[model samples]
Target: MHERLSFFVKRDSALHHLNPLTKIVLALSIILVSIFSPWYWTSHGLLLVVIVPLVFIGKVANEYFTSALRLILPAAGFIFFMQAFFQPIGQTVIFNFWFLDITQESLLFAFRIATRITVMISAFTLFLLTTHPSELMSDLTRRGLPPQFAYVIISTLQILPQMQAKAQTIIAAQRSRGLDTESTFFKRIGSVVPLVSPLVFGSLVEVEERAIAIEARGFTSKKAKTSLYEISDRSSDKFIRWGLVILVIISIVLKLWLS
Candidate 1:
């Protein structure tokens, strides 16, 4: 599972060389545009055109699509069912079944919501695949974030692999003890409860141990903290950062004028 998370494109592309802060800002801007724009075709078309090129730039377009489908399809299904049956919109009803009505507006609304979520997820996936977690944390620290915050972010990334290994070990151990996770739906879920308890408990203990270790190492001292990696603001990164800002302004103006 962690291997899937490591589904990144390793390349010496311009997107890879960009500072994480630039990517984060640009991704967030795209997300904002998708969310705040009117749930209509014009707004979504703009986002689609803008983000499609990022796939080529990041060189993880295939993985990005897979990741988006893994998350977005199920979410879209839920939205479709809910909006179609429960919150039907529009003056004209297309279908009526018992107490539920499906309207054209509801369908369009669901599609809009699903597309918006897909775009946002794709943006984040591109960011994750293109930017290293360590570099992102370092960028955050350099941008006036607390050192402890950066440490937490970096630790989370490091812990994910450990957690995956521990989970697999726990599952195998439980299976040896006759707890079958491949059993019926409820039974499988029930098996997971016991299998996961030890992992969660172990993580809690590990966190405490890490906290103590940090304290022992004087991590909370008043002295400035030094990082192994330093974040430098390159000219190209600055140019892209400013360019994204301009694009965001243009997007907002277009939205206001068109809407």
Candidate 2:
């Protein structure tokens, strides 16, 4: 499962036991507050004081931080640097890079955006790590989310690894035939046909078979479906969800007032 795109980890903690809907609400609320709140410190506070602490509270700190370092930090850093260098000219220049300048105002703006992104992705990362995809899908299905949507979501997550493996196989085969990734741009361009045709069409061809298989399982049946595993929700889950919802509403109100 480690090689799969789904990031769920097996953990025995209060967070892991929370109903999938509760966790989704929690993650969404944190993301909304960090992005839309009026206070300058709110995003940073949520990241440092809320999401980071929840990592340990959920007992998945190691996996969460691994995802942060491997995926979130690089993306946030790229956005930060791009904003810092390319933003409109301002008075106080802190650093210069040839034709580009980093000013205090742009630095502050970039930092704010980066912190918001960090909070948003971290919230999702924690939720994904603690909650299984099947549980999330099942709960959403129970809540009247379309069954097709659930199938698409779970299948999309699982398909990534298969696509990647197919790409690697194509690359290896091309390499054996003298295709070079490190070669000139034109050569790489030449290799793309060999590399991508099979990868793309291979996936496309399998879709029909997968659809047939799903239909065979009565995917579109009107009868009520049963879950193989039972998910439990408790009073605490309800309390946390309500509290988060109220907090999100307050944040939106504050943003409106400030504007």
Candidate 3:
């Protein structure tokens, strides 16, 4: 069997064995609490106290940190710099340059937003690193999620990597054919059309092929299909999910009360 394309790393750990829905709830709870909490440092606290430790508990610390440094930090850092300079939320200027000034309030606001984004991405990264996408879909499908909805979720998760791989292949082929992709800025911009045309067309053809293949496998059939692997949703999983729900409620209440 061909291995599935996903962020999942195979390992034995408490976090890995938790029900996929429980992990989903856990990630969402972290994100919601960080976003809705009244305290300015809530996101930073969650990142340090909860998400970081969970990375170790899941036994994927090295992989998680690699992904954070490679992908998550750059995205969050960009947002931080943009919001710090352009948010225009406060008047107490702390630093000034020709046309750009950093106010104390803006800095604080940007820090909160950046940290919230970091917590959000890190929690989801942890979830994906631990939970297999197929397993997640199977659990959701067994729990009464519509087959089409589950398939959409699975597709969304897997598409980006597929597209990225496809783009690289296309770029390599173009370079082999004497395409000028790296010489100058305008040449790079001009090369984008050639790269994009094939990528878009190829992706469309792939979608059609996948649709035909799934249809042949009875994707539209109403009969219950069996999963090759069983997903466990133990009592502990339910308890954890409920606890996350409670935490989310508390955060929302606190935000409202403080407001």
Candidate 4:
């Protein structure tokens, strides 16, 4: 779960050379475009033509493929399947599973939904893969994003993996003491309390210490903050950001017109 959340793959590539903010704009633009596209197949086409190519351009194709297989596919697949069975718009029935019927209209709708979801996730996955968390925060801070927001974002990213590790440790300890996570559904439901309680309380215990640590480091200092690592924005990065802004505008216009 955390692996999917913090899926940064460091590589020296064209995508990595772009400013963090540029990548963010690009990601947001793609997400908006996919969601508001006039054509049914627009999102699917973007996923295949834009996102797949971006994985190679970023030189993190291997990691992107891994994430798509492990995380993206499963999530999008479930939603697609659910919508196909339950959506109420279809006239032509494709199949029937007891009370649930899959219809042609529902299948098309689900296809669009799944494709949009893929485009959204793939765009952000590429952005995170190329840009470091600190670099992203520093760039945003330079552009008037609150310093506290930066601290919060970076701190959350840093702590998530540790929290995941702690959860795994607790699960392992419980499993050793005869907790069966793979048993029946009711058993798994019953097991949630034991698994979550420890992780929740343990994380809570660290909150005070984390607050103190941030305060000691002058987290709220009014002086202009400095970045240890410099990320230079080139003319090309500016051009790309402007292009993405235009694309976002176009997407919104199309959405309104369609509605």
Candidate 5:
């Protein structure tokens, strides 16, 4: 269950070894192009031609697939379904149920939007799977990102797993104490107070503990701090980042001209 919340997968592969900034740029590039490109099939092509192959190349195919099935697909599916039913765009209605109707044009539009969302999510997933959060934060800090901002980003990435773990622990403890979480709907809703109270308080305690811990480590010191690990930015990483930038520029130009 904790692994489900943790996105980074340790693997020995070229994709995993790439500079974290390069991976960030790569993910952003895919997302920008997918959203901005005028071509209807751009997202589909990116998923098949780029994202899928990168998963295997990163040696994180299993983890990526699991994340996609559990999280990404459900989200995109919800968006697709909502847009298909609720979007009042187009006249050729193919299916109608009371106030909800699915038109041919609306269906196509929903598919395009959902596919673009999938592509964006998949790109970020791939990056997270290959690049550890610490490495990414450290690299960004070295590249002129303020440490305060870097700490915030890393904390955001890590806090979800911590909160999930805490929630599970609280739920288990409550279950052992005869809490009725498995009862009817209202009973379950009532049981949530017992579960959430501890989780929220525990999280607040943790935040206080972390603040003290960081302060003790001279987190606010003006002196330059050294990293335990030296992050590399090789020529290849630079080349890839530049190429991605050029592609993004081209995508913007194409969208402008075509639109």
Candidate 6:
């Protein structure tokens, strides 16, 4: 399970073959477009058209949808309640209750916001599920991010598994001590706090040790750093990067012309 979580899905799909940098840039572009474009269904529909196919191609549709739903549902609920209560009164009210009014415009706006968030969430989830965390760190470092920043990103990824293992160990040790995790909500919460306190302290110490180790290994003084794995830049990568740049330019031009 640890091995599965750490590695990328080894598929022979075109997206899997693209350089991680290209994928990151594309994902960011889509996210930016989704956020800045008009909060309308058309803009969100276009984003979905692009992302849904990719999710299917990557064979992570279920995971992507699950992650997206977890974010979208709460967001949708909040938008619904807020708009239903706080939206400005308009000439065309859809519903009137005692002292509240829900206008058609507000309903549309709420729908637009919820759809936009869904598109953004789905776009990011697809990107994260497809790209390996290590590859993302390497790409960032190659793109001139400080080695320290890359180390921080990589360390964060490494820490998740370590923390999980440590938590399991602590839970077992506590169980041996007759601590009950299946007690009332407050009791379970209280019991786990002390059990996990050492893990939190240990993580801080580990981080300090890592920082010292990195500095001692000449990470800061080195003029150049090399990666163990190199992401090959092929003709296809160049073509795709250029294509995306052209697409962004076209989108901007269209937006201006239409406006």
Model 2 per-residue lDDT tens digits across residues 1-259: 3255777889899889899999999999999998789988899999889998889999998898888899999999999999999998688999998989999999999999998988889999999899998889998898899999988888888888878888988899889988887779998888888899999999999989998998999998988888887789899889999999999999999999989
The per-prediction CA RMSD against the true structure, in angstroms, equals: 3.2, 2.2, 2.5, 3.2, 2.7, 3.5
Better of 1 and 5 by TM-score: 5
lDDT of 5 at 119: 97
**For model 1, how many clashes?**
0
**CA shift at 135, candidate 4, in angstroms?**
0.7
Candidate 4: tens digits of C-alpha lDDT, residues 1-259: 4442466777889888889999999899999888777877889889989999988889999899999999899989999999998898878998988889999899999989988888898898888889888888888889899988987787777778888899999999999999988889999999999999999999999899989997999977899866788889999899988888888788789878987
TM-score of each: 0.82, 0.91, 0.87, 0.85, 0.87, 0.78
Q: What is the TM-score of candidate 5?
A: 0.87
Clashes of each: 0, 0, 0, 0, 0, 0
Cα lDDT of model 4 overall? 0.87
RMSD in Å for candidate 1, one decimal?
3.2
Candidate No. with top TM-score: 2
Q: After superposition, how far is residue 45 of candidate 6 from its true place, in Å?
A: 2.0
As for model 3, its CA RMSD to the true structure in angstroms is 2.5
Q: Which ten residues in a row have the lowest lDDT in candidate 3?
A: 1-10
* lDDT (Cα, tens digit) per residue for candidate 1, span 1-259: 4442344568777788888898899888788777766547743674568777777776777777777678767776787678667775686888899988888887787777767777777777788888887778777877788889877767777788889899989988888989978969999888868988999999998888899999999878978767787666799888888887887787688778878
* Candidate achieving higher lDDT, 2 or 4: 2
TM-score quality measure for candidate 3: 0.87
- Please report how far candidate 3 places residue 21 from its true position, in Å: 0.3
Q: How does model 5 fare in lDDT?
A: 0.91
| TM-score-sorted candidate list, best first | 2, 3, 5, 4, 1, 6
lDDT of each: 0.77, 0.90, 0.91, 0.87, 0.91, 0.74
